[model samples]
Target: MASATFRATDAEIANPERGMYVWAADDLAAWTQAQADAQFAAGYRIVYTPVRLDRYAGEALPRKQLDALNESFATARRAGLKLIPRFIYNYPGGETGYQAAQDAPLERVLGHIGQLTPVLKENADVIAYLQAGFVGAWGEWHTSSNNLTLPAARTRIRDALLAALPADRFLQLRYPPYLMAWALQAPRWRDGSGASRIGVHNDCFLASSTDVGTYSEDAATRRRERDYVAALSAVAPFGGETCNPADAVDPTPRGDCDDILREGRQFGLTYLNDTYYRKLFHTRWEAQGCLADVKRLMGYRFELKALRHSPAVAAGQSGDLTLTLRNSGWARAFNPRGVHMLLKHRFTGAVVRITVASIDPRSWLPGTTSESSARFAVPAGTLTGAYDVLLALPDGAGSLAGDVRYSVRPANADDAVRAQGWDGMLGAFRTGTTLNVL
Candidate 1:
């Protein structure tokens, strides 16, 4: 994991340069489209979709929802985001708003579980984690007269939900104040291992004494919140932090979007998600502010080792290869668009050939990353033993392609998981010891 050393004070994620998730609206198309803009922006790289949970429970989720998830994922990928599902515990309508905290029925609210069970099982690839420490004003506040309060009872139910979730995933804790005084102790989790992945989600922007738009811009307010999160790193380890007012509204702002990120660095925050408000959802230009933030932070230095490919025993009509694509360097590589490397074959002469499909890498991690790969068959036959493999942009940009050292042989039965195809563009087949087919 990139964030293995991320202690209480570090940004608790593996790769913060691009580990950005956005809390989007309920509308699938709009959310996906908005994420594209967020991707173009510098900061928001990972996208948490469908802000409204009602549609997820009552509508799009009930259908074979994979296609919508695909479209949203595709949108995020195109916009350069690693897609993540932001699970909500309760839907908006039907006794959601204005209800007394004590009077609300836990089971009825918890009933959303049955609805989310299948969704999580099916879409865990893009799913980030369930959103907690939230309520009416959209799960962003703490200790207000707001909608959801982090009572022990509700948090226990949340722990149950996480128990039912799959492997290598995490939980994003939105409001950390209540978390420290009341939330974290509700559940116990030993983290970063396959059986015990646990984490937190925090942000510096919040409600204000002035206008909501003016919240983070306040001189005294931004500093206090920044220090508050920095302080939390000492106790509550935040895996992610989503800072808003990602905008630059001048007026002598002490720490703007850039500052929120620097805090993530100081506090050992691993994953960083961005929240886009309702008013600015429609504009592409508004998103560039986010894009710049991401680029600035992604400048971490890493030591890189080339991937080693398999030797060709025989060249048949079809086959595949798996290489030890090691991160020789200490740093990790994260995809801004989520699809980073493209494989290409150099033919005898100047004629170059490329893989029919692109390579979809696993979770953006650091140090000797294991790369699983697959390719198809050759129609006829050719001079086979050892062939050259080149790495570069997906489109073969001469200006962008990296070194050529990796090679591929054949794929084994243990490879290929239908579930793996759910996230990025995952469909490149490797035949047997021979050439590749479809």
Candidate 2:
């Protein structure tokens, strides 16, 4: 009849598929395992790599280039880091502005996507989500020398990318209107269709009144667009980076802690670019005393508030365990993951695992507390002994199911939880309580 309560930690967690992500070198091949290790050591679990295809705009990607791309995924897998990959043709600016930025024609773009589909599917384990790129300047989908910005062109590109990516994965566009134009249904994508999997990534976050044209300038239109993005973000991933304050439309000196936190919560912001406009925004947040908060609350910070379980149970009998958790982050996990309950024998090292099928971590929204219960049955052959209780939220990909680096850890205070409570080898959190099997 004993229950244990756990305290939450304010420290930042380097959980998989979320938080501030640094940019890798332009060449995916240049993303070495050493670089991944360093980033993970620096408390980063995600890396953003822009795959440049400007040279192959008129033709198919060479075998060497494709091999390099595959190598990047391998590196990520070895280092236990996920990637936010974007395939773009050109950056903004030349003799002309974005208008002169030369992206591939519609046919060529689709061809490139078709070529990249296999790589994407093969590496979906390491890919957090694919950004909708390969159009306009800097892959923001604005200007296109090939008229890829036209309504029909955009539709074709969107559909092609969605088709290319794994159905479980999401594709994030640069603007809100792109999603609104296509997804007329509700925000939640339970149907697993292409439209349901589409989300928004605002590259120009907090840069202006409308985030540098991410939303409409018209009052009525802007309201509707923001509403759509907010609703969509509840179920899909929503993230981006801060643009230069100089580019702000109002230019009233944004990036204050209050405004940043307000908008972050409003849009359910998840991952953000840690490299871009750092001095203007990140540094300011640090000085203003909200940088750590932003880092800790970006994606999904689950805290174990309490645990209830039977102190002892007979072999072959079932015992109920319940957990009270709070998602203190700005957004929930958009991708699917596995929830499990484990009983590790203290003496023999034998483990018993039960999949908690009733709970989905993705549905654990920010600023909300949820209680999930599961029943675990002891094997008839189990030895009568004390067994440690553990909880695991691991990646859904079969390839990553055993990797602790891809698992979710509760943001519980180190002092309140057992020392080394997070078992790297088992990829589970020790509940600081043991069960006796009679």
Candidate 3:
């Protein structure tokens, strides 16, 4: 057995930036510095908001709206919050106000997508994920006045959106059947390249027997939906909102904390709407005093249990680097993250980074301890000195490549290792271990 070295870290329960997200709408004013700072202070790291295109269904998005969106992204970045953006042209009961001439035509909708692609790619650093919207009322991909639900139309729009996004980010479809259909059309989706990035989102989660029609009414079909979602969620990101107050089980909160927690684990939920279902989380769940726990397990919470490695290493050589990490939160990091071992000179401020591709953060499921072993090597020409070992999980691309805001915070009580930058960037976390290079 290898020698064990324990890092000085306490298991405190108030780690932020993972659990709950505040819901924000399209208004640029709402995402101001004050508002976002308030959220950050409350331990929130994400904001769920919609980019409504109801006004620009036929033409390009007005300059005013686009500018507001850019401002919102900037505000979010300043406040150290990631954004979950959904682009929609309709809302609940949108059919009543839907007009054929003014309603966006298929061609115009595709045009809008083309227009939005640049903005998305530019801000990919701060985006958590994009919901496959641009169809149906409320962007749920259902109950639409336009023929967006048609197989051809839906496929065309979906393909365009997929092609438009940056390769690192994944898109979530509202329904499972639609995903199946898209997969069938694209054969290359079978190899986990495409399928691994596509996910599911159910707006009416746990609202009724069929989750308010999120799943199939038929027992057999429902089982298939569950199985399909489970498979996709294993590798991809999945999450959504609780049911509306008008749902069938409304006014009484459908299930207790146990039921909700069990189902969340079963579904592999990565995020949920904290602004909605106020009664369920505030009253029903809070009365039982499980609200904090529910928030704790909402998304991915990784804790560094212990790390073991060779005490002495040689320059220009390889050695075993082992890490014992645990996912104490409810879900995993649903996006592509890069794991690296960073070595910084104790006195000289020299730095060397070794990428570890073997550790895929997506596979780190909740309630499971993962052992990661990598053969780390120091470069050919290095000064003989003591160096600090650090761990960095960064987006690897975009403006926030080295920005600590996109990195994961290990839930440990070690102040030095877990400290963030003055601007709230995680930069890179220390490993509490040092190696001598000779």
Candidate 4:
């Protein structure tokens, strides 16, 4: 049992693989057979979210995608697993004929929710939410959304949803700063209407348009998820960073579990999954294909409340720089389970020196995010090339992420040069350094 009085329900744990990346399937049988074989070999259950009809098929609620997805659901159930049929809406392409009818009454939205719920109810696992700013999220690779302009329509749709969804059904609003603000002032529904489970999911790990790429947790994405959770939580109870699964990535994975776990707990989110579209293929060797890396990121976000650390550095120095760390995660090291934060350096190809910390593989659960510090001394003879600090966390009673770098040549850090390095040939392989766990 979770320590919290308001822990997540059984539905949230539909399947607990820690991370998920998906493959497309014109035929569900083919995907199921392939995935089953892979899962057995991986020694882990794989979380596969089928492509919603809103994507590739052009059917906002296309029967075919649903049918194909149902097949996958059937397979998952048989294998003792779960499948979330992702439904992305409000995108220009997803603008169904029915949307125009929503209007102030939101009748169209209600009818649509009403229409789809029944089709999915029998497959209770099909229970899920919507992508509020669906097509507009750069995180989703369909970033042309600013041009697509989902706009304020999400509120209306959300209103209709209040009356349509069941008590436990959830809907994730993609990066809606505006909605977050509005949600703060208003509840998900007017009260007597039905309870709507709402939250935020971001493509923090995603990097490209139709590309399965991602970036490490920076201040902005953190701010967004934090803000969204802050806002959405006012109306609902949970939220999370919908990260992508990664195998190989630059800057490596780091300090994210702090944010991930922080937001999960703070926002009432006990369960987390990737954006339905934020994924790379197992065969994909691109920097975006960080499934292995993303694995280190599952289930760590608790509830981050603006706890930030500032480094005391000036020039290129070998001194230990300490930044203020916070307990934004769900659990503390003192708990039955402990969460630990690690820092590492991307030293050479296929090699990363686990400089400051290591992965504590033994503890971690689906709803634990602990707070800790990241301290590392610049190597005595470190040169002036480029370097990064990584943070690794995971899902457990304690923490489940691994070593993540936090800084490089701290004292000499430059705004312009660092800016150049920012979004640079990112998604590329950095030097290989391995951090042996403690």
Candidate 5:
């Protein structure tokens, strides 16, 4: 029997589906794999792309545009990045040639959703989540010339987006009241039902006391909305970026580290825009010495603390392995992932994989410590040799099951752990503990 304890590392990890994301507003037809690779090389694993549908406001999306959209997904997959995609009908100065912004009517919007459903389904593996867009200016669900923000119209759009998205994915709403209002009527949202798949994204985060109308202006109502968002974020995704601080209503220390970190933890923020509102992230946070913390703590950061296992076992016998870890980030993983243990023969290169079904990474909440153990059997007729042990946390999607790009790597600081622990090819972590099979 041997046991070892490890310490946490402060270095930034380029984990998937979390951290700061670069905003890509260019047409997907022009997106290049080289651009995506550059972003990934700079330590970003996610990109926030707005799919503008203004040209097709009155008609369905053409096959050419659909293929271009699919190519964007292929680019992300090739570059090892995920996307926070939003399909929008209009931008501020779009080619609609109207004084006021205009979005399609409810019927046309529904038709567009039907046309985009298949593409969304096919590339769902690379889509981190879809934003509930397609209304008003900038697809923010406000000030629609067609009055799409009206309760009846908004409900129809929400339902259609949910139905169009893949079942395993989440749809982020622009406003908190939309989610709160729906939860009141459905009640199932309080539990982990279909409603749980809906989450919140605030583009004007920390721009005011209420995030510039993202939350209620009324104090009591705002409290309730924040509470609900906190609860929903426990099981879903909550992320966004700061708007222009100069335009803030209550401009007193809004984007400071104290305010940002407090709200980040409360909302369980998963991702943020690295390119937007540089005053806060680039200047203020940098001068205040919290930019690094914000970068490392935005999403889930799992760090292994200790491990204990049987040092030797015989063929057809069982061996015990236990690991203690802590989630040191602001949020847990919102999507489903699998935990696995692998044993590889030192000379023969034969590997045995055992799934540790007892633990789910989504339940590993921020700032909490948890332990998981597995008793695996040494298969009959196994080679008698020293085997290297490893840990893997892989995406649950069948298409991405063995891809290391979608897997999670622990933040451990030991020299051996830092140097030899990560198996980028295998998407697993070497435990530094070997088991001898007799």
Candidate 6:
């Protein structure tokens, strides 16, 4: 029989690697900091920035622009936030559509990615994912003056960007057909193991039957694309925004929250734009009192079902710890995060962390439970006292490893734990269960 030490019920609170995103460029310093801080305070951890390359379609991004972009990344890092970055050549013209005047040549777009590779690589830690955005207005890859949709140009651009990014970072395409075509040509994409590291994003999600052309107009093609997106999201990140309610042509659904939940689970969505058409969401769902559910289920909400271990241990001793966790959110964590068990002094607050190398939290899919066990080594010390065992999910990267801003909190309704701020991190929850070290 196992001796359980800690148990918890699921609760709603903001975690990391998922949430509503702030839409703006990182280089917009004044707007970036204010938005990032406000969003962070409100329990959001992701920001979507469209890095406009429209101004210099014919030339390299100016030095000033590059510096500004780097500064924006630094700001996000400081604020302990992640950004979903897209590089676009043109903004959508409200009525005219497809303003080709500012569109960059295919070659220029590829060159720009190569030039920006250094910055992207340097700050890859803060990027949630890169949306392939060099073509088309609003970077949706349609109605473009440039013929980037042509197979050859598209392939070359995709290859260049893929080569520029590190293997870990994911890139998102606008359409599923585009990726399906590419997959047919490359066996890696067909492997369905996320080797291609590419996924799709639906900007005008759930607007119309065709979702504003996110999928094919034909019924069969739409089904195929939907399946493709579902398959891709099993291992890759997939998400987007709800389109403006006023523009939705579909009358039957009428922003049904149930439909949203159904499709969200079906598609394995990892994130969404919270601000766009948000008023409609508030008006429709808030009064009905289901918006809180939507917020909790958006990305990955992990709960600790049970934790068991030896109730007592000698100083410098090694012992076994086991944890059973359930993922209640809509999707899995699409990025890497560290899982460690912390042994903290009750009085002095000194801590010793044992990282579990065998457990990868990214594989914790929704509606599923998983068990993990690992041996923890307690440090040799002179003082013998009771210790608080805490669980920490911090960024694996060394720079952010010590920053509690990057640590993830569990969705348990323990106000004492929530208020106690885990390990020196202010406003950060470090989940705990008690243990004694003699």
The candidate that achieves the highest lDDT relative to the unseen native structure: 2
Report every candidate's CA lDDT: 0.38, 0.85, 0.70, 0.35, 0.83, 0.74
Q: Which rank order by lDDT, best down to worst?
A: 2, 5, 6, 3, 1, 4
TM-score of 4: 0.41
- For 37-156, candidate 2 gives per-residue lDDT tens digits of 898889889898889898999898999888989988998898889999999888764424776788988999998999999999999989998999898888889877888889999999
lDDT of 3 at 212: 70
What does candidate 3 score on TM?
Answer: 0.85
**Each prediction's TM-score versus the true structure:** 0.48, 0.94, 0.85, 0.41, 0.92, 0.89
**What is the alpha-carbon lDDT for the whole of candidate 5?**
0.83
lDDT of 3 by residue, 195-270 (tens): 5567888777766666777777787988888777766766667788886535443233465777677778877777
Each candidate: how many clashes?
A: 52, 0, 3, 60, 0, 0
Best by TM-score: 2
What does candidate 1's lDDT look like per residue over 372-397, in tens digits? 55554443444433333333223121
Model 5 stretches astray by more than 4 angstroms: 93-99, 185-192, 245-253, 312-319, 377-382, 417-420
Sort all candidates by TM-score, best to worst. Answer: 2, 5, 6, 3, 1, 4
Q: Give me the displacement of residue 401 in model 3, in angstroms.
A: 3.2
Candidate 4 wrongly placed segments (more than 4 Å)? 1-30, 40-66, 88-115, 126-152, 159-164, 185-196, 205-438
Which RMSD values do the candidates have, in order? Answer: 12.4, 2.2, 4.1, 18.5, 2.8, 3.3
